[model samples]
Target: EFYTQPVQSSVTQLGADIYTGDNCALNTGSGKREVVVPVKFQFEFATLPKVALNFDQIDCTDATNQTRIGVQPRNITTKGFDCVFYTWNENKVYSLRADYIPTAE
Candidate 1:
């Protein structure tokens, strides 16, 4: 069904919009109920810094589930880091990309 309302979705100023769901349509088959929509996000810390991260949210229809997907910095290492560390004078920082996946499970 076409949304009677314009679904409001936003990304971080630095986050990359990967794929917005062309998810469901008025012609959607009953078996084709769910599809995964993910936003790829990247953050570059010019100055090495620590952050607590959260992607945005999408409201759902009944009997649906959504989840955060892709590689989370917090998942790979003890500390979720964009990069290992920075050298004082190097001026090189960290860059990371993670996919936020929301799906119906």
Candidate 2:
């Protein structure tokens, strides 16, 4: 027996651009102890994507005496965004490894 039938289906594609290998230093000064790490995407996205970050490794100057560290994303765009690494007191961040992933829906 031979039969012909058309199958109806829909496919949705999701994309996520990942950018890593950001090993920078954060030398915080007085007043506000924070560092703005600007990130530029390799390729521009069609729409504004959600930026997600993960601080894999962080090395501070002081090991024992160090304040709480905080991070935030600002000025997000289709091209890039900035990751702000801050601390309460004057604790200089020697180096840090941050990985960013931008996803579009």
Candidate 3:
């Protein structure tokens, strides 16, 4: 599953922000499933800022045996970033609660 949310500036750090909320993806197969959730920012920066995934706060449910969840940032742009969620099981649902950290150019 893949989705996006509106950017909220009031809930962000000075240079960082949370562009998405509660984005979830489900793995219905027995192998690793990867889903890419797109996040939009308020403004386009001059350079690509550093992006990070808050994996510690992730909420996963209905996971199979030996299921593992992983997250990462990819295809980053000046305007937004992609939060990639990975799961290693069938019928596993991974919820994302990611944060973006902007770096000084």
Candidate 4:
């Protein structure tokens, strides 16, 4: 399944508009699932921005399941950010949300 949502800018100066979602099946194969969603920013920032991945919820039903699941930002740029979702079990499904924010410095 695929999903996407537009990110509105609370600060008008930023003028942020981006689309983020997963591009893979709910049930993935045995290995790492690369989550690279496309981002559309109206304006540029003073420096390279940062990508944040937050796992709001996750469900995996298996008594003997010994799989580890996690999501992290692998790369970040003005265009978009590359996130990687990894899982050792092939039957796990995850729900994640991403955000792009300007750098502190």
Highest lDDT model number: 2
lDDT of 1 by residue, 1-103 (tens): 6769767543223333322233322112333222233222343323323333343323223223322222232322221233111112212112222233221
lDDT, model 4: 0.50
Q: Once superposed on the true structure, which residue ranges of model 3 sit more than 4 Å away at CA?
A: 1-25, 61-67
Clashing pairs in 1: 69-101
RMSD of each: 21.1, 7.2, 12.9, 12.8
Q: Candidate 1 versus the native: TM-score?
A: 0.20
- Leading candidate by TM-score: 2
CA lDDT, candidate 3, residue 35: 77
lDDT of 4 at 29: 63
Off by over 4 Å in 1: 1-13, 24-53, 64-105
Determine which window of 10 residues in candidate 4 has minimal summed lDDT.
11-20
> Which residue ranges in model 4 land beyond 4 Å of their true spot?
1-23, 41-43, 98-104
Candidate 3 colliding pairs: none
CA lDDT, candidate 2, residue 23:
38
Model 2 is weakest, by summed lDDT over 10 consecutive residues, at 11-20
lDDT of 4 by residue, 18-96 (tens): 3224434434565555445455455655457665555554554334666566666565665545556555555455444
Model 3 per-residue lDDT tens digits across residues 17-84: 33224544453555677777777767777766776556546555653345477768788887877778
User: If both were scored by lDDT, which would come out higher, candidate 1 or candidate 2?
Assistant: 2
